[model samples]
Target chain A: MKRIRMIALVAAGTVVASALSACSGGSEDGGKDGSDGPVTVSVMEFQQSRIDAVAKLIPGFEADMKKQGKDIKVKLVADPLTDDQFKTKVTQQLIAKQAPDLIDIGDSLVPGWAGAGYLAPLDDYLKGWDGWDHYYPHIKKAMVRQDGKIYALVHDTGVQNLFYRKDQLTQFGIDTAQPATWDDLISRLEQIKQKTGGTPIVIPAGTAWGGSTWTEGFQPILGGTDKNYYSLETGKWDLKSPGFRAVFDLYHTMYSKGLLPVQDLENPNPWEPTKYVKFPEGKIQVSAQGTSGWKFDWGPQGKAPIKGLNEKVDTWQYPGLRSGDAPFGWSGLGFGYGIPASSPNKDAAMLLAQYLSTGKPLADQLVSSGAASPRDDLADVKPYADEPKLLQAGKDLATSVYVPTGDGAEQVAQAVAAATELIINGKADGAQAYDAFLKNATDLLGPTLVKE
Target chain B: MTTIAATASAAAGPTGQASPKRRRRRTWPVVLLLLGPAALLIVVFILAPAVYGAYLSLTNTQLTGFAARDPQFVGVDNYTYLLSNSEFLASLGRTGEFVLYSAIIGQTVLGMTAAVLLARPWVRGKGLVGAAILMPMVVPEVVASLAWASVLSNNSAGTLNRLTGLFGADATDWLQVVPLASVVVVNIWRGIAFAMIMFQAALEDVPGELIEAARMDGATALQIFRFVTLPLIRGPVFLYLLLTTISTIGAFGLVYFLTQGGPGGRTTISAIYIYERALQFSQIGIGSAASMILLALVLVLGLVYVRLAKVEV
Candidate 1:
């Protein structure tokens, strides 16, 4: 009995020891390798298509480093998740201090990550690069955080517009001219509804689409209004302002008037069918979409092959809130590579990011990945010259507004999207939904953090 | 083997008392070897994470910032916040309704009916019926969700809508119009097979003599099912309810793949709410707090199940 008890105890001990050892064995001492033998710099790219394109350029970077008498090993890690999931993954990595040396991020994510101190400012390094001056001023402005620090290198910029069915509009004898204001836009939608006899508009509006509703659906109206939601001078969230109410009112009108496809917007992929199937089939007459819609969504080589689509659809600027101010719409800052503060290979990472943001390699990657560069000089480049939609995107970038970077901007966007969804679903009217949204935001971020 | 050994040992009255000690002595090493790895896994994966999660619940830990590196403890602030937060509370209530409607009532009633019907020797094509009923449960959850989404889509292409249109009904988007009802039906279809198998096994063990005797005594078919069959399967019924209730409460992937807690939070069950808070929103403290609350609720339910099982015995 005594001997058996001893064996049992020994067996249990072995099992416990093995389990504990297995966990500890998986962790690596991966942070900061400054010593020279062969430095391994880890890069985390946000989207797969961009990463695959970047992966091809790694050898070029390595060869360039060799010419400069440096041996650097670049390890690229692609973010295999949706935008929301990517944010969570990056957060977990940052918290654990296991973050990669380089990170590919969107402009909306920049403010949140920068505020959390996960990003290393690139202003000093960017100044050393010759290509910095070639970047568009507005695009450059999008990368700077509230603290007046540039945290990322601008790679591509997305220009959004109101994409409409020109063939259908001409067929119906409705005016195909661009709307000068929100009321004009509304009247056009109403006309489309009366003539086309189907849902005339669709915007990204559901929780599944996350922050797109805020960026694509609501941001243009807010940008056109007299007062914006976030004030840089006071550093306060002003969602209760007239600007927010107007945006909400616009959605409420679209929903109440039955000018928007309420059912399609509620689908898991809110923008997929509306933009691809319905718009192409002339069912949805107008949609607010980005430059990608022209290049990768309905372009010649797009997933949905719409013959003569460029002729069928016409792109116009997001209508202004009133007739006086220049038309406005949200421009996605696309993806930019930045260094994490915790990265040990900060200098090397910065060098690589700078190289990837400029010249032939950057333009090549942009072309291969179906992205439009933020640089003005890239227009005369081969692929950009070949693609008319890319050239058109270049023109639209002059007036498009990127979301201003702030501490709680991502949260603000999500809150607005949720509020807009509430109204769109008929669960609450505009005013009640805005009030509830204000209360929710105040609860998450304290009342003092947000201004009423 | 155990039964035969016990019977033989009983014949040796004096040695029978000593046999238990010898048996334990011989069996303990084997038992320890078999159970040691399982216990270790439970401790390492489940218990450790749970304890750590509880610890995390008390802190103002976030995904990033100073909170990420060094989280500050704030006592029961997370718990207090959850109590006052209407969305969290509403999600908890919604989860209860979902489990009740989909698992307890829907799966049990339909599964029991199928089992009772198939148990009849006179029933035709039992093999075909059994396979068809069990097919949904056998399919991967993701595949099942995709199939259901395709069938119930609100588009002109959706199979169900296409069928409904033949009768002159409008091609309504079932997922949008009745999101919760659609999910509940899908879950019922998936879970019914498990419940049916459990009840079937229990009913087969029930003495055919007793059933025939009940019938000869002028007991109706419904009466036999209600008083006789149901009583015999009380233990298995409790077991099935316990299993299905816990699974339904914890279900996330299928519903998330379908609704994403969308159409204005109509289907935002507690599981989805917890995921959105902890993972998506990066509010680790709030997520952990919600997790603890869910764990406590599940525990209370398990205790109730145990007490009921004891009563049945």
Candidate 2:
């Protein structure tokens, strides 16, 4: 009887230990070096095409490894989660100490994620990397964290272009050249609306488009004002600034005058009809969109392919609020890979990130997805040489303003989205929306954080 | 297993009768030994996490940034934040609306109606009707949501829009125009089968004679149902109400996958709000505080159901 009881206690202890070990998922291997053996480095990827893009690049990394007599296999973890879910998944995995070796995240997310110690600082790796200085100056600036340490690599950079149907502009007899000011852009849009009898310009808005409502819609206009939400000097979100009101007023002006697509912004996926269907079918003649739309939305392989894209479509640099003010929009950033500090194989992970960032692999992303290279010598790249529009957008990256990224950035973006949503619904004009933005910003970040 | 009889017997070597104190002593260790593994599992898996969550609610912990690295204790601050959060408060109200419309009114009524119809001996195509009613229960939540997303999506090509077009009704963005109602309806669609199954088992045990006796007393059909059938199935009804209400309040995946609390926060129920705060927005402290509030609400409701209805379980 005593023997049996002892055995039962031993058995129960074993079960509990086993259960906990199973839950651990080898978290003790946080710094385990798998260099001597066959090592698999998992990467978190959210899109199939982008995953396929990485799949194409993995062979190069592994073959290069094989040349050095090391074995490394890449595993792509497919996540088709929503944007918020994508953040949540990575955050949870990082907290649980089960993160994949590499995280493919937006350039904006790099600061916050790295600040939490979820990502490894790449500054040590950059010291020996030959390709560190090859990226464009802006891309290089974006790679360094506010703490003056490198956190990520810029994969490929692109800018938001103020694109219009050249043929439609010709028919309307409106100037096809870059709009010199907000008034010029609005007048051109009004002219297009008068001729076409439909909404001519679309800047994405509302919560349905998620972060894009702020990033692509509101912040672009705010960028034209030459003031940003986060002030680096004081380190406070600028709520009472005129730049805040200016962006809202611009939204109110366009929306109240029926120049914007208010109805489509309420759709389940706001960008679908506006970017894919209406734009390609010539229902809307002018819009600001990422340069990736060249391959992802209007090229031959695009969902709604526009015929004669090169000749038919033309783009202008984003113009300022007033005439002769320098052009600015929320552009000049790139999405890329980062290594989790908890990763067992940091060396292999950085190798994969570097391999994906430079040379033929980087050029292929441009041809395949129109993810223009962040390299300073992008003009010499074969893919950029073949595409003039991409070349122009690449050159324009020199002047674009990348959104400052850090801890409170996401909350600030949410505030802008809320403000724009009010304007989109016609619930508030510029002043009222700015009031709403201020209130929401204070609510999100607390009273002490938000300032004039 | 039985008080470790060998030890007890060895100790009882001289005495013919075991002392009451020794017997009491032996029984407790045996009882504790019996309950040990189960209690250990509960502490490790359930209670510990729940207590930790309660502790988390009082802190300034977040999913990222400075707060994540060094969470500071801020007693009741998280609770105050959640209470003042307009979005969080509105989400609670929306959850109440969902519970009332989707579970209390919609599922119960529709499920009872189907069960009553199927209970009738003269009902035709009973198997077909039963199968159709139960089909949704077998469909995965995501697959059902995907199908409904396509059906209720905007554009003329949507299934429901195509159907309504035949009547000259203009295509409407169903999810946006009536966001709450759309989610309530989808939730109702998914939840009806559970209520139906519960009611069917319940209605089967309702003695036919009592219902017949009520009818024989010149009671109308409605009166017979009100006095006879309802009272007989009261236990299961109360049980189902308790389960359905709690489950609906806690529901996230079905409605989340379908709408994600969108189209101007119309469908932002408590679950979605909790998820948004904790994970998406990375306000773990506030999320945990809100979760405690939700837990309290569920507890109060559960107690009310049991005490008011005089429920057995």
Candidate 3:
């Protein structure tokens, strides 16, 4: 009886100790990551569709670390919620100081995140990295935050184009050549409407459509305005200028005249019905879309491929606001990875992140999700060199600007989206929407941050 | 003598097998042993989070920006902002409409109808009928919403569209046109089975003589149902409404899946508004404040129901 009592007491004590220890979160040296143990670098990829392709980079990363005499293991963490929920999930984790080691963050989000001190500046790390010089100056410029510190590596970039169906243009007796000006573009839309009796153009609008409204729809047109939304020199958002008015005016024309499918823009998944379905079916003839329209959306491996989409779809550069001006395009937001300040193994994680940005892994991203590498040297690399169209697009980067997606840019995008939404819903016109947007932007960014 | 003793014993305590002092002494151990785990769970899981939420509501906690790093305590600002915020106010009205349409009228009425019809002796294949009625409850909310999304799709070849086409009408995207009503319809389909089961159980307990006497006294079926059947099942109906009202107010998945509170915020009910502010925009303080306000409203409404039902929480 005494022996049995002693055993029971020992068992109970063990159980209690176990429960108490379990309640304690974790320790760095408890076989997770320590000086002696293999460093476990947690890498998060927000896009579920691209998770597998991203995970394939782990083995290569670990092997590279081994050659450097570093023991490392890469663990891939996917966004628990939908891809749309990345901002929320990442923000929550960062604020709680439980962030994953390396994060594939959107370029627009870099300023806010880095400013908030969630991200550790990559300037020191990049200075040590020999491969940093290969990135184009335009691409490198996008990586700099408001603090003039490089916060991330720009892995991939894309440019938007005015995609029009060739068959529709032929049937409508429209010109096969690119429109020279905003008026010319509007006239073509009018002709398509008159000839086909369908909504002829849809530049993505509405809040649900998110940043696409600003980037794909309005950013390219900013080249025509001869003004930028944010001036690095003045350090002020140019809300008071006629630049925004000219851009919104075009949207007003598109929406007020029923040129675009406003209803489809207001839905949850904004791009699907209009860009993917109607555009492919030749119901809606013209749209402003990223290179993904051919590379992913209607590629052979796309969710809904249009037969001979590359052959059928014709492209036009976005025209200037005036009748006599140069057309423009951009290497859009440098979608790349940043090391979080709370990351356990920042050095190991940074190494993995930088590795994933170059060569075959970056090449696969284009095929997986239409991400074009900003590194100019990738043209000589086999996988990237093989994809001639992607290579050509990368080579064409010298002609375009890096779309400015710096401090307070996402809010600026939201303000633009909200104003565009009002226009699309017929609640406000161009001038009224601009005023509303300016007021909203001023309110959000503070009067000191914005200038009229 | 035996009856008096039994009455005395009953008046002593619950089991009435022990002396009053002894029973009182034993109750402490019983309470600790039986209810301690449940009490601990409730405190840890529910109460702690609720208290934390209340505290968070008073701060300027954000998910990003400088505020996310070290949140500042700004007392009552979020609540004041909520009072003046047009979007949040608009969502309250939308939520009210959703609850009334989906819960009070749609689920309760339709479910009672099913229960009444199925409870009749002449009704055939009661097992199949019960299963059919319960199938919606068996289907997960996400699955149901996805199926409905496909059914209410914009495609001309969609299920609902094809059915409408059969009737010589053109196909229409019902979700786009009637966003609120479309969600209400799906919510009704999802929740009706719960109401049916509750009402069916109540109907089983209802005395048959009262319903029969009304019918025998030259009363119509409708009159008998209204005067006799309804009064008998009033408790069950009240219980169903109380539960369904709260559930409908908190409905998120169905509406989120179908519309995501879109098409110019047409279907953005209060829950969606909270989610948008808290998670989407990363405005934690405002969302928490909104959540607290919603909680208070629910609590008050629950108290009102308790006053009417004269029951415990």
Candidate 4:
């Protein structure tokens, strides 16, 4: 019995020892290199397919680097995550000081990231590069910080426009020509709603993507103000300003007048196929969408998916309130690439960013891949010039005016969402909702009045 | 001398049988041996981590930049901050509501009714019914959540809405319009099987003779059940209730995939709040404080149930 007990104790001790040893081994293996390996680049999962195309340019890039005898190998890590997950993951990595070497920062998040000191200043890289001269001034301004540092290079730009069904508009006795003003667009929608029992317009209001309605829809009205919504030039909030209140009132009126689908405001479906798909099928009439809408919504099962969609579907600018005074919409650059401060291979990452943004790579790969190039050198690129709709979109983004940076743009967005909810639910009238919105905006952004 | 030693050794017939006291003394080593693994596990995995977590809960620690960025000892500031946040308070309320409606009322009621019906000998294929009832419990929570989400989808093409459309009713956005109800329904469906299995096992242990005797004494079926069968299974019922309550409080996946705490914070529960604060907002200190509070709440509730129910092994 004594011998058996000893054997059992030995066996149990071995099991315990093995388990503890295994855990220790795992930690040691993970921490072994201590950041002394080939420099790895982190790219968004959305750009994974583009990485291969980028890899083809690496031979020339590496040959240039080898002349300097850096002897560094580059590896790309693609983090394909949805918007929310991507933000959360990137934020956590930044907070943890484990951020990927290269990050594809969307335009909306660039300001916040730069403010947080998570991005590196790219002034040194930009100064020597001739590509900087070719970039649009507004695109350059969007990427630069107040501290006189460029944090990101613009990778792609997109345009947003009002997409309408030509047949449906003609049926409602409305002009299919470009809208010149907000009132003209509203009148067209009102006519459609009166003539057709179907929803006149579909706006995504449930998800963040739905929030783009305000971006493409209301920003134009707000941008037309003398000081804009929030004047970066003045560094002050203009909450009580006429331009701000007018835009809020416009949103309230559009929602209250039954022009857009109220049910879609809280529709849980992230991508409401019914809205875009049904519009093309003659079930729904019109939509405000991005350039990608051609491929995503209008082509196959899109508005005129029945074979001649390109001819039947029409794209137009918002009409001006009066003759010859077209109200130009606000346009902003979309997303871009940047080197993270935590990157191990800054030189290689910088080269990759430059290569992707300049010359044949810029015009051939980036633009041909359905994105607009930031460089003016590629302004007359073939695919964009040949495609009429894409050409129109490119022009809109190039020439359109933009709103002055708003004070707390994110907070303003939240207020708009709350106001939309109230209007959709009929808890408050349009004027009342607009008032509440103005109050929230002023409270969050401080009062500096502007009116229409 | 040799003969005397031989006689003395022979007197001790066997070592263990030599004396009762000696045998009793040897049992201490056996007890210690038996408890060694459990004690070691408690010290390494449970007690040590718990102590570490408590230390972390008192400090404000962020995860980046300087290696020597010392953590500040904030005392109860984190807790105070969390309690003051309206979002956190709303989440607590939502969690409490979920636990009450879904776990306590829905699961318990449905589980008991199913158990009672299955317990009857006249119910054909009782074994098959029991297996079918337990099927949902065996499925991973995520898969169950996905299944429920599809069935209760807000779109017109969703299973439930499509079925309802056949009856000439308009489709309803189940998740968006009624976020809380959506989570509650899914939770009840997911958790009912667990309660049912527990109740079935408990009911099986109840003495049929006692119930039959009560019925023979001019008692109705309901009266017999209320008086005799219920008291016998009270312990198991209490156990199931405690388990279900605790599980419901920490429920994450079901609500996460279903409503995502959206249509404006209506379905945001305490678990999701902790996740967003810690992972999304990078507020580790606040998240840790919330976790500690949750732990305390669960512990206190467990203690109260134990005291009130007086459950026997």
Candidate 5:
């Protein structure tokens, strides 16, 4: 009887131990107290290059936090991933309540994360923080959602426009002036095709590149329209807006006429060949690209930087749908620090984020990564002041168009991409593609939410 | 009759009744010691996740906030949604076609031919040829896909286009023209090696005596192979078919890198479909439903395969 009792006790103990181990919340302690031992703040980074840059700046942040009387220990969770993989991992982590204290949040992912309640609104924190005043109005605007909540701190801004090969255009006797409208742009593309007999222009398309086709390609074209794809005031998808069909028409004309490199768009690395290989060799005359393309792709530190590239390439604002509308570009915040709602060390995390968002750390990150800083004052700093090209590109921000941000915004972006892909791949005509897109949007966001 | 029973019981005594109890008590610890870790692993890694995933399939769980804070149980709504979705249905059909062409027909036929030819004693440099055939399978899937991407690219730099250029033909965009067929060909190239290795082992196991006996009976080489060799290897062939089919259905990395389910959703397999829905679109509930459907399809196919082939173990 004694032996049997002992065995039962041991077996029960084993099962309980195993259950306890399995049930443990993977070391995530909810932030209920802060006066314990050093508060560990988990920092998640997705991009490798950005991780390396951020890793170097963490010590500064930690020291600054320590000086401010917050004993903080920063745990770096740097997992390199592709854009799609990053989304899945971040969402899974956030849902499991295992998300890091501070995570890299892009402006594009802000609405989705904020709506999902994965991110904690930083409005309260920003109001008390001194760094908030230093941020430009556009930077502040880019980080806030339709709910009037600022979800993330602005670290870097992405400035994009139409980049053309000026020397090639001159050689082909093509006009180098800014295209006033879609017709003018099309005529110029035709001239380049007839004269150069190469790919006239290249815009990212297809399901491979995913949301970028909508952001980098369609949204810029959409920007030139009478209305945007989504209205922030009502938080609804404008699927039936003339801008929607016009964007599809633009793709239809470009694809059907072979003006764009339709075949190359299907390649896995669509941007690489066009930006690095074709653009340098004068095979592609024009591309809708970020203004930082010069500094990152064909500048001194770039991969396959061409000799005398500044003389070869010239940046122009992406044109409008009709004449008399000013050429505009798309600008948005890049990766910024956002504390997850489930963070155990929210206070410590916010402190570290505040420290890193400005001063030496921010300047270091911007310089090392070649990203434009959100702070206008940082431009007069050593590196930004020295680089004339960077300043010139930064000036395009005056005409930048910020996309709508709200719940279901990602779905809206995807709907646009699907429509554009349909027209570009010859799956459907503009009208048919528009109709299919309307149905897709209606299915995604119920008919009440989508203005079809 | 009572006397006979009494004598039998007297002979057996108490041992028979107590033996089973004694054996079970003695062996219980040993059973636990041996099977405990494996059982725990199955429960924790495989069974737990599968059960959790099945539970997730019945919800309105998305990657968005509603699903994040509180995932509502919608009870088969995800299944209904997927059923009505044309893209999901088309992807399922494409997956079936991909498995049939790449795994069942292409890899099996090509692998069997290579294995049979290489197994012959008269074949010279068999090792070299075997190594050459196994090259793609040995290389990592992602690396092989990237290398094949370069070779199969439609651009001016592509080897295929360059080769065609020498023949005075214009560069053919093979992948763009027929995206599914292109991925099928690439998958076949990568998979043929595994099939060859498996079939070659099975071919080698075929008894030489039977072949000689068939030959002695005036059977031709082909007849000897057909009559004697084929019957012996049918078991392995069926097993290979089962494994290859299941594996091919799960093939995502290679196809993902090569096409990412485009020109316009042509190459999107069930796995890619699940990924796009779950990860890209943040519709986890729908993705789970699709996954369950795929799992059921694989299971049904496997059951049918076993039943038809009458494979033992």
Candidate 6:
């Protein structure tokens, strides 16, 4: 009985010890950095390699700051969360008052965070910075809130294009030249599908992130205006608008006529390289993909699985459904850096944000990293200017209309996703889906719904 | 008789009554000393958090930004909304179906077969087979999910599709078409090992003499197993049933990594639905309410298991 009692006591003691250890571990690590130490700047960097490149350049920044009599030390960190996880984590941290000094906020999240007072107003910083003038007007407009305050810097923007196999299009007797209208593209898709017995166009409709292909790739053509889905001038949701309805009908007609890859839409795996791999192998004809695919997934940079695919690949502006006008594409300053409102070192944080946004180091890094810089001053940078495909993409982005950022943006996007899902699943006809989407938009936007 | 008993008690009572009461009072301190830390830890960690979660569930307690600005007393609004939400209802149905098929049927049948095979004296390398079968339980959940995903990939390059192609069968999107079944298979693969090990231990505890006696009575192997072996291992089987049911209900990682409750919510279990609602959509109030409902269900199931199936050692 005594032996059993001793064993039970030891087991209980171990459990207590483990519980105490678990509780104390977190606090102990935090307290190890004594007070009055260097200001720790936690940053959620989306790009790991970019963060590493920034880290390498930090010593120079620190040296420059020291020469200016600032004793601040810099610490760059990278903890990438997926799109959904990033939203949830950043929101949670903001509410808990535990947000990092700097965060990479998506363009879609700017209005929501700004309205919630999680972002610090960057208007004062922008006024003093000359590089603000170099930002394309539409990109700058995208960062501005309804209250007329800039909350973020446009870092990198991407352009959507109709990527097709030149050989495949030629074989099907379809023109490789820019499509005159949405109908022209659809007709070509039908021709390609019929001639080759292969899928024509593949759009990602499996997950929420992939669902953006419709909103980003196709909606601009349908809506006609640069201000496609959201109208900033009118402060209204555009779903009920004629242009939006036309786009939905066009997409539905395309789906019904088998001009789209119907099987892969419902398949869970996103149709990225999997869809395009077939295209290069002569099994698929056309796909809607971002411009980066030219260099990253198709060219010599890509391995044997997708090698030499870019040699036969070409791109054109997504065609407009409305006759007599070019389809105004939707563009936004992709993702940018913002200082948290609750940061202890707000000025220093702003300085870091500026350093990343407009400074020479950032431009140099972008040039070396082969990424496009948002600043027009760096527009002539060799890597971006010399790359033929990237140059075209950059020019397109500079000229495109940006999706508006404000009060009903998130809700409108969600409604659009639901409508697209209905269209893809064949649950609702094109007109019905468009009407349902508009109704949802009107409910979300309330007074913001535009008349006529 | 009372007078004689009173005389005998009068002689004995004065010697011990006060001392016995004093000794009982002294033992209370030792009891507190032994159980004090454990009770404190439980109250602080498990019980406190559970109570706090319940309180938060009652309020409109969102986890972020403006939603946390002024959390209002919403009462049962969240619960009412979730009860009506088609998505949540579908997820509950899916989870119930998964638990029934994977945990109940898969684990029981596979575990019982392994137990029966291992119990046989003629079986060679029984320990090796047990270890080999139990390997999946040791593999990390993420790694296992990735392995299953690779096999279920819709691409023609995937292993299962490649094998099917050899037999002149068309490649099908296995995960997309049969998401629930894929997740169910993955869950069963990870979970069956535990059930098998438990049942195997229970089967070893059954007396060999009884089986030998049954065999002497001209009973076949199936008859001996049904009448003698099964009854002996009833305790472990009951314990495993309860454990497997609860675990399967809470299964998340495999489904999340492999299917992500996709192809139109076919694979969405209750846990995945709660995650999507709370974390993805930032609808914490609804998520908390659904969680509380799940807790209630688990508690009821647990009580029933204890009452009807528990074997007191």
In terms of lDDT, which candidate is strongest? 2
TM-scores of the first chain across all predictions?
Answer: 0.89, 0.91, 0.90, 0.78, 0.91, 0.81
* Complex DockQ per candidate: 0.40, 0.47, 0.38, 0.18, 0.36, 0.26
Question: Chain B alone: TM-score in each candidate?
Answer: 0.91, 0.88, 0.91, 0.86, 0.89, 0.86
Mark the 10 consecutive residues where model 3 chain B has the least summed lDDT.
Answer: B25-34
Query: How good is model 2 by TM-score?
Result: 0.92
Q: Over the stretch A1-452, how does candidate 1's per-residue lDDT look in tens digits?
A: 46756888888898878776764424332444566566777788766566777888899998999999878878888766767778878877765567788888866677667777888888888888888998988777766767888988878777777888899889988888877787888898898888767889887775767767776777766776654677765667776677776667778888888998887787777766788788878899888877777655776666465689878988778777754766665577777887888777888898788778877777776665456788877877775667777666777777667657476665666677778778777877778777877877776665545776
Model 6: lDDT equals 0.69
Native-referenced DockQ of model 2: 0.47
lDDT of each: 0.79, 0.80, 0.78, 0.65, 0.78, 0.69
The candidate maximizing DockQ is: 2
Per-residue CA lDDT of model 2 for A1-452, tens digit only, reads 45545766776787688778778775322233554557777877776557677777788888998998877877878776656668888888988888889888877677678878888888888878888778777777766666677777778678886778898889779899877788888988888888888999888787777777766777777766756567555556767766787778888999988998887776757777888888888888887888877876788876568999888888887778854577664574657788998888898888888887777777777766676778875577676568776777777777777656566766777777777777887789989988988887787776545664
* Candidate 1 residue-wise lDDT, B1-313, digit = tens: 5754664465446745656676665665657776877977888789999999999999977664323545779899999999998888989988998999999999999999999999998999999999999999999999999999999987778999899989988888888889999999999999999999998999899999999999999999999888998888888898888889989999998899888887678889999998987877667888999999999998889779878875442
Write the residue-wise lDDT of candidate 6 on A201-251 in tens digits. 765442344325444544545545434556556655555456777767766
Could you list the CA RMSD of all candidates, in the order they appear?
4.1, 3.6, 4.6, 7.2, 5.1, 6.3
The alpha-carbon deviation from the true structure for residue B275 of candidate 5, after best TM-score superposition, in angstroms, is 1.1
Q: Candidate 2 at residue A131, lDDT?
A: 84
TM-score of structure candidate 3: 0.89
Q: What pairs collide in candidate 2?
A: none
lDDT tens readout by residue for model 3, A178-242: 87787888888888888778898878788877666776776677655655667765556877777
lDDT of 6 at A198: 65
